[model samples]
Target: MGDRKDVRPGVGAPAAEPGRVAYDHHWARDLHSSIRCSAAFLALLFAIDWGTGDLTWWRSALWLTLALLLFLVLCPPRVCAGEGWMASRALLRSRRVRTDLLVSVRTLDGVAQLLVLRDAVGGRVEIDPRVLVNNPDLWYRLDEDARKSAASGCLRSGTDTLRHFSERLERETALTVFRISGLDS
Candidate 1:
């Protein structure tokens, strides 16, 4: 990761690029966490079964199947900067302060989503497994107000947060937004 991109409030000064804003690998971290949780759950079930001395074949099969299912359900998918990853990579690259274009991506759950707010009408959109790739350094360098605005936007409008982040990035460098997963959290 490069140096943190400082987010100035409304000045729109294009500061020097903070080293290099490497892509963050958050999906792997989340997948690891999911695997660990699934394993722990399976272990707990096994331990309970062993302590109770109830090793029925059906129970064993059932527990194994359940654990497998849970892992499949919880594990984050292997993702990169693929086509399905972000909705507005092009928009992110070409536009600056364009509120007319927004990006929104759906999560694996299909309910919660991460959005990139280029402006009121347009921004970056995110979807499942890909949402796990949010970059922390890119996020941290943001000005306090921008962060707050994004966080609040996340709470209010899912797509609005994209603007704060995009704005932060635009303020820092001219490089395109790169998404990576599995970097140190």
Candidate 2:
């Protein structure tokens, strides 16, 4: 109902604690595009069903099911941040970890680069690299947390992987700078 919000740490909303923050797809225009696509599919189907001058129970059921499933699967999670902990929230579940306890950050090969983050306490999360590339502020928050983790004893390994991540970030940053300054094609 109106009392319940789709994502727990919704949008630009702050967390329960004063210093915490949350990020979700609400910030992206993709949310509207997704809804439009689903609606368009059902509308198209409805027009066809009406034009045929025939109505069937199965046809209605199929369209309803299709809309529900698309929204369910495409729904994005909210990434929440605290002083040392970060959490990802979905409609049905949530995952959290102590950012200061980070142990490794490696890129897994897939359709695109998948960054996997692991902590000393066995907390792990795999997310798209585009997430960071798209949101520099989010990347800054994570980078600060990782520095704290490295300073503490909780982070014991994965320097190489961390280095690679920073290198890539730096390369992208430099490219962005050049592009903005009209120095690069």
TM-score of 1: 0.42
Clashes of each: 23, 0
**Tens-digit lDDT track for model 2 on 34-117?**
777788888888788889976588888998798878877776666656667777666788777777789877789977677778
Best by TM-score: 2
The residue-by-residue lDDT of candidate 1 on 1-185, one tens digit each, is: 98866766688666544343323467668778888988888889999999999978899888888888888777654322321122222211332222222223222343654433333444443333234325544333223324444554532443344454456556444333332333324
Model 2 accuracy (lDDT, Cα): 0.73
Which residue window of length 10 is worst by lDDT in model 1?
A: 83-92
Best by lDDT: 2
**What residue runs in model 1 are displaced by over 4 Å at the alpha carbon?**
1-24, 82-112, 116-133, 136-161, 164-185
Off by over 4 Å in 2: 1-28, 51-55
